[model samples]
Target: MARLPEPLTPLIQRTSIRQVGRILSNTQLSPFSMEMRISWNAPQTLPVPGQFFTILPCRYPLTLLRRPFAYSAVTESWFAFIYDIVGPATRDMAKLKAEDDADWIGPLGRGFPLPSPDVKPILVAGGAGVGPVFFLSNVLAGRGSAHLVVIGAREAKRLIRLEWPSHAEVRLCAEDGGTGITGTVIDGIGQQDMADKVFYSCGPAPMMAAVHRLAAECGCPSWVSVEEMMACGVGACQGCAVAAAGNGGPQEYKRICDEGPVFASGDLIW
Candidate 1:
């Protein structure tokens, strides 16, 4: 069951517009994350890297349901979301302030696919999923491609500081060893070199099911970015169902807000 690869499909067909976005800076990166920074008015397309976006607060309306996130760092006009305040609609979206006004929608769902240039792309992030694996390791270092990011946190002020990706090759786990390579992220994917590498995970859910069981025991080929809990980011509220691997009948369910918050870790059911 390892023949997945073919889900990138989004050259255009993006029409989601609730629109408003204007905040522009909210700060506080770790110790429970939060990076807000919106402004984007360019929306006919623009959100790649495990796409997602939902926001809805407009002067603190607590929670009616729009919260989704992901897509940390984009710039045609502006975009950035690194959330993790946890409750009360992300603590009222960190009390938004720089010019306030929020009520978005997005380049929603399905993203993170681009890995067949002869393997080697790793990624992995955890907790606030380090903003779409630092926006997919800066789009795999702007396509020059040398990748391998890792990230993970649980100490060291709960990491997530951002501004990495100078050509990727980061790695900073910290399950309390205080920083860089101490534990978790499966001990930084067990010190890398997973043969022809391909993984591309994103935060919790047992750390993306232990990086898809160590990328299927190193036979490598993985992808995930699911994070659930949505009332309706789209897909009309099937309520973010997950769990679907092969035959269970009727495709057994799949819609982390519309067919994926990026999938293909052997197509779910972990």
Candidate 2:
């Protein structure tokens, strides 16, 4: 495994879960993806930018486990999640109509630390990982923080081109050179001065590992949002355990949904 830089512990606060939510709109973004905006009635508080939720489909039976999805964006009364259709759960979710109900449990897990106004923020995302990272990017914009955004996908169509804040510099990458650069998202990072900036990333493990490696090389502390096969979406299942970073001691494991779906980059033994 590649060595990643040590990351700062994120600011954490536990959030209550909502039992039900109504879908306001469910629009297909591409052949395999869709975006849903939902009304959760009254949330204890708005979810921090990097948090995720576990959504249970009221209509699916074969799929017993709730699907975990990161918040792509949020508003006062509504929140959005973007998902790619890969299994029975998501395929059923795609059939949700406006006014349909979906059970939800979240704003679960730790979120990325807020960046200081004086620090430049850089966000890197690949594939479906764009969901959370884009939310964080919007939060940065709301804070009046300028940022650089790098996104990668298998092809141009897989890449998301959202209306990011005007202050953000967006870079695109595709493995097939179908959109921007011809390489991985890590290749898009190039040789920018990461040392002076705060870095946040989410994606396939290999991509994130590369990002963390680059951060280590540049002496940049980073935060990473990770994905795992989840069962309960809460601590009860004891599923989704990931190894903790560091050796020379007892090996430790952290639960993805309960302990985090987000963590300081190098803290995970990737």
Most accurate candidate by lDDT: 2
Put down candidate 1 lDDT per residue, 1-270, tens digits, no spaces. Answer: 233344456722366667787787899876688888888777666778888878887898757777788887788888887878878778777877899988888877778877765667778887888888888788778878787788887787788867786788788888888878888888886754666677888888888888888888777789888887887787886878887887656667877878788877877877
Against the hidden reference, what TM-scores do the models get?
Answer: 0.35, 0.92
Instruction: For candidate 2, write residues 39-136 as lDDT tens digits.
Output: 97656577776778888876665677778899999887888988888887788889989998888887787777777666787899976788898888
Report clash pairs, candidate 2: none
Misplaced by over 4 Å in model 1 are: 1-7, 19-31, 34-49, 54-56, 60-68, 71-92, 95-102, 108-110, 114-123, 130-151, 154-172, 175-187, 199-270
List pairs with backbone clashes in candidate 1.
none
